[model samples]
Target chain A: MSTVVLLTLTGLGLAALYFLVASGLALVFGLADVLNFAHGLFLSVGAYGTWWASGNLPGAGASGWGFVLAVIFGVVCGTVVAALVELVLIRPLYSRTIEQVLVTVGLSLAGVALLQASWGADPRTYPRPQWTQELTEVAGARVPNDRFLLIGAAVIVLAGLLAFLKFTRIGLVIRAGVEDRSMVTALGIDVRRAFTLVFAIGGAAAALAGALGGVYAGSISPTGGSSLLIFGFIVVVIGGMGSVVGAAYAAVAVGLLQQFVNYTSPGLGDICVVALLAIVLLIRPQGITGKVATS
Target chain B: MLRIEGLSAWHGEAQVLRDVDLFVERGEVVTLCGRNGAGKTTLLRCVMGLHGNQTGAVHLDGDDITARKVHQRARRGLGWVPDDRGAYATLTVAEHLTLPPVVGPAPWSLEQVHEAFPALYTRRASPATKLSGGEQQMLALARVLRMGATVLLCDEPTEGLSPLLVQQVGEILRRAKALGVTVLLVEQNIHFATTVADRHYLLAEGRIVGHFDNTDIHSREADLLAHLGI
Candidate 1:
């Protein structure tokens, strides 16, 4: 049925965004053991960056170019913010888990306040690309072009990330560092560089999600960061805290569940996600795909 | 070449290494022999810059590395194979060898390392957690060798390994010395150390109590064992 196609498409689109955000959180935690509480703020900052770029830059208001430019600018800005946070706050707190949590939470609150002060509390709308606004008919089902674009982008990012992890030297070290930092350092690896690189990449991924959400949903609000943060955390917990593949699968599952719940009763969507998270925890304390840590 | 002068390390308030002075010339295999709580591990950590509250000077190739970080010390040709083996659960045996930045000239290639330690070739794709204790030890040693460390600081490299693997480890160290690599190892096994080392320092209660060359090691074995209470 057309309804099934619509639900699947929409669910996949939403899952892509969730994967982006959750994967960033997972990677940062995996590498540095720094549970970045300020991660959600990166999303809002990125959304705002895109808004500023599209509005201020000349010729950026045109179709595909505008959205693409906005996303690029947003990702860069978000990376800068995350790099600064790492330098100023994260580096010193590497051995102190409680301190890292406290400091990052404070940073997130400050980020939200800064955004409110600069952009005001009003919700801002982001214009979808002209090309993406048109609906396409596929197998007698109507779907927006941007939905397909979102899914394509997700696949590309996932493939690119996997290839990088599997083939590149830095990626190998990052993967190694995630499991045993001291060993990586012993091998003469500059693990700080690895941590920094992962943190920056995580920030960029989160920012990309923000930009994607802004384009597809057409709105950026002050509470956007916290809301996305909750969703990301839920996905991570369900997927396994440090597994990217697990996050992707979990995100899609959550997205589909949310869409189904929304179709039945809008109020029950979030409740369903929480219930699913609880069930996953109860069944596999280590999350769906997580192996019990050995060392 | 490696030197430790007036090295004193502390775990919080209690000092573990007291004015520990030691040296290993290029192409020599030196073992710091001691029992448990003798500050052998702490001395190696201080050299690696892992112990922050240490007041000491570690020199590598006549350069003061006392102030350097762990990674910096490593980059300066100090390779550490800690007792824990630094095995990462996520990385496979092949990745462990490839992950560290290759340093120095004419280091062992992957094929060469596989040939040197045949047990690793079969488990090249196995994660660290899946590998047996002996396999992990071999992987750890292989990693440092592949990284081309001129001075290898191995902390209990043969601990918890089978006797066969221990003999293999001894052979590996002998081969390393023949290739002109310097080794500073902490060992509880005197038999293994005697097979590999040119000189030995007996450590007790965080200080260097005695030193002996290989020629005198046999004569000093009983005295050393008494000091080690073996």
Candidate 2:
């Protein structure tokens, strides 16, 4: 029973990380129609940003409100980078699908290489609050407190994203744009602005995930985001491209399945995930929620 | 209040519109009549800035807007009701009605829109995809009217609608004209066009071939219908 409880909690923590990365990916793809391969780079930027701020920023440290400040800084950095990418790179190649994909793929590779050059290839110990490193007993099992933090953060992000989509004017434009972008523009709304906004939002969320993920794993590396990004892509595909709620559900399924299967056989978890993806594709090609533009 | 002078458009290597010139005065309802591939839809797309392979001058209220973007043209008081109705799958009816910014001075209020379109009012909370075809068409027209478009570029507004719904659409277009909205319509329904439009331009092979008022149309109704292949 304790083993089950521990596995469940751990799986949820992993799910939270996947949700953070996939939600942004879905939104960017849904609204902009740009398959942004550099999304992993955004996550890396966030993780590295938080790590750097904890040591270098005057008011930020590894614990308490200082850690919170560092996370904010990292998110802001990611947001700025995302917005810049949309303005400078993606905007110029609008409506050129192949070109956009190639540019993003090239950017992802170049971004990682740049990071490796600057920070070296070694994994660095991530600075986290002392409390997160400790554990709390739950259901006769010792569960890491970071699991709760990850779950809590994911819940908040999910709620916040839903509210943003539901109640805001930009949200309305985004929803409409996803359905028919040309129609939205015919209504006189500037959809390119919405594109930039989605990129920023996606960046912020991915960065938050990067920061939280480093804490969960106890270390951060330049390639860390790319590694998690593979799962992120799987989660997005399983959830449906552009649906946040779907991402959350798929993340939970993937994470839990991986945790349970990996426990039984050392390296079978990843293969199982691929099998699950194939089964899903064969059964429902549009994904669990269907690709209906952020619904 | 709207004019196009020497407009020419192309799709890659093939030219579609050729030196097209037309105008609609303030509060006038004009119809562009053509057969399939006669560049009617392409003309509307060019005016709305949706098509890029174009050259010539599009003047809205005597201001050259040839280089304006789609949103910019829309913001300049050109409301478009596309043939497809352009309803969103995710947005509700109310959201669709309220999505476009009010660019003109005499835009309809929510109360006015609700009074004008009671079906839309009842289905206000429903997603646009859930609405029937007639309802979607009505919602499309209502959305533009709510935005208070000074010049409406409506393409095939009555296509595929029932006789009853077509009458409703005609009534709405008449109401828009009464409210001082200039309209440039592309329609195959000649009987409906004569009832709502002041004048018509016959387009063939991408150029304006003939112009007629209601009386001229009534005299040459059969010939015009045969020409339009309707």
Candidate 3:
């Protein structure tokens, strides 16, 4: 019972991390119509940026404040990378939806190679800064403070994203664009600008998730990013592709379920995630949340 | 004003339009009338630069827009409200007005659109997908008016509206004409054409077969009916 409870909390915590990273990916694909294979690569970039900034700016007024600086740096790096990709690559591929994937896939491969070249292909740690190293007891269960912090941060991001999408002009335009790009453009707003902004926002969110996940898990690597990317893809598919709330729910469900299966059969744990995704897809071809309403 | 000359377009070589030539002066509410499959919609799409495979010289106030993108043409004062109204199915009526990119300051506002179509004001918060056909059409026109367009291309605006609402929509077109916005209207309803159009072009099999200006439609009713297959 204790094992299930502890592992479940761990799974949920990690699920929170996945939600933070993957929802942005799902949003970009659903709205911008970009395959964005480089999404996970951006997360890796965020983790590495955080690691570099924290070490270089060690005098960040204290460990927590240093952690804050690292996050800000990660977001900045990711946003810049995203905007550049949009301006340089994605903006040209609007009419050719099929080739959009080809370009992004090539980019993702290049990104992975770039990371390997820069960081030597080995796992690197974010050091679990002293402030987060301490453990805590919550509701009689022992939990790592950093994991809890990760969970809290994930929740906050989720809420903030929901509010932004629901209330903002850009968010409303994005929702409409997903329905009819021609109509949105005909209204005289440059849809190209919206696509670029969406990409940047998605990249920034995923970067933060990458930074947080690296610290929570204690390491990150070029190859390590592939697994997170695949997991995010699975979550998006099962939760309903392009659905922010759906991604969150699916992530938690898959995370906990995968962890439970891991206890029973570590090999099957991976299989379980794939199997669950397949089942969901077969039952709801549009995904669990189904197609974006585009309202 | 809008003008097209030697405009040719195709749907992968099936050729929907052939050297089509037409024009609409400012404040003109012109109708392109034809039976089913006469390329009326194709001509409109070509003028709007929406047909993927196309060749044409489309001019707006004497500016050549032959190769302009749809959005570029739109930004240059052209607005198209598709037959379907292109409702953002999940969006509210209020969102419908706000989501499209507005080109400039317009005489119309949310309040004016609401006043023009009071039924919309009553259901401003309702999902667009859930609105009645007439209500949907109203919201569609209202949405475009909010976008500050000088030229409006409305395809089959009254296709599915009630008779009374159809009359009301004609009034709306008259109102748009008074605002000096040029309109290229395509319709199947002869009564609608007779009531609203300043000029009429009868099309048959992707070709213009007959024409009648405002002062002359009465004399050419037979030719119009024969060409229109009405």
Candidate 4:
């Protein structure tokens, strides 16, 4: 019914965050070959950074540009953390995939702990501001106006990102690097610089995702990123790891599927979705989208 | 234009290359002809300075390039088209041609390379993975030419090309020699060496075993084959 349609729409609206976070992680993993477990921590930090900037900053960003200010702050904090992590940790373990996996996992845990201490364990509310409370009728159901904004924002962000990756110089280098690290470097590209930029970009996108997630969920806990991490992993797995477009498509499909489960079984909806994903893995080991093009 | 002295490389104590002494002057097409496991590719890699534990003195343009990064050497006019062709699967032939960071470029463009080898122009927009072996080799060559380097280290440039395409490659090399490009071509094709290379340095068990000029290689075919273990 109309409720199910609303739920599906809600899922689509949320797919924006998934696309942002997963695409960045996919690039990092694909290009740098780093399995970054600490990626989710950037989300929580981005959420907190947005909160601090929009909620506490002086009259500078307190006006109608609160949302934009929050997003910018999130991007900055995300990028800084990414650079720090790369310089301090990832640089040492470059090309050591197994060590990278272990270190990133440990770093991730440490990041969660750091967020818990900095922002506290209790969840924090992030209201979508007064202007965003407007309602719209979707399939005869009243939908929050902010949800429409979320959907629009996601589309805009994704389109802009796609354009950047397609048309820009660094973007072309990045895509090329993912295909063959050796060949790209041999062509006079500094692989290290590209790797750092890729990680920073991923961090920025994760931060943006956090900001969007704050508006959508109404509150974000310190551990908010953990669930996101899980969801991203599932989407990446199902979509075929290292594929940007595949992650986008898989996010929508998984989001809709999750919404359907919520409708079918309210209490065990999460479990139902997990079971469905398990079934998917059993059938398609390469995931729903299959492998990316190798060099 | 290039020199390596007492260069030794180890893949974590395996010691793949030992005291490898090699040199190539400007505008020279020298071949690192060698037997299997003779470290021909390793010598090319050493010149590129692509390994961390590689101990050597690599000099280019009369400067010690031993400490420089791989890309730095590349920018200093060392272009390497690896044996793998390095064909980025998703990238189009046009993108591959356009992506290399070309400096001081009074050289060929994609149009010119395509004019030289028309097959590339035909598949200009095609994904590189979809290209046939011959076309892929052409793409790699075109991509390197687009980089506008003075020296090219082509590791097995004619590995999997058809005979007709191989003939075309020999013509390309002849044209390249005319263009004043120094080619350190690592080739297995005897015909290619006889056709295009001015000099040959055969290697065995990671050391230079024999040297030959174009005429020496043609007349001493048995010695060349025996030295290369072909």
For each candidate, report its DockQ versus the true two-chain complex: 0.49, 0.78, 0.59, 0.52
Cα-based lDDT at residue B78, candidate 4:
83
Worst 10 residues of 1 chain A by lDDT: A286-295
Pairs in steric clash, model 3: A187-B101, A189-B101, A295-B90, A295-B91
Compared with the true structure, what per-residue lDDT tens digits does model 2 show for residues A96-172? Answer: 99999899989988988888899988989999799998989998999989999999999999999989988999998
Candidate number achieving the greatest TM-score relative to the actual structure? 2
TM-score to true structure, per model: 0.88, 0.95, 0.94, 0.90
Task: Report the CA-based lDDT of candidate 2 relative to the real structure.
Answer: 0.92
| Model 4 TM-score relative to the real fold | 0.90
Point out where model 3 deviates above 4 Å. Answer: A293-295, B101-106, B214-223
* lDDT tens per residue, model 1, B29-107: 9999887999999988888887778887888889998878788888888888889888877778888887888777757
Cα-based lDDT at residue B181, candidate 2? 96
Looking at model 4, residue A186 earns an lDDT score of: 77
* lDDT score at residue B9, model 2, on the 0-100 scale: 98
lDDT of 2 at B156: 92
- Cα displacement (angstroms), candidate 4, residue A80, comes to 3.6
**If both were scored by TM-score, which would come out higher, candidate 1 or candidate 2?**
2
Which candidate leads the pack in lDDT?
2
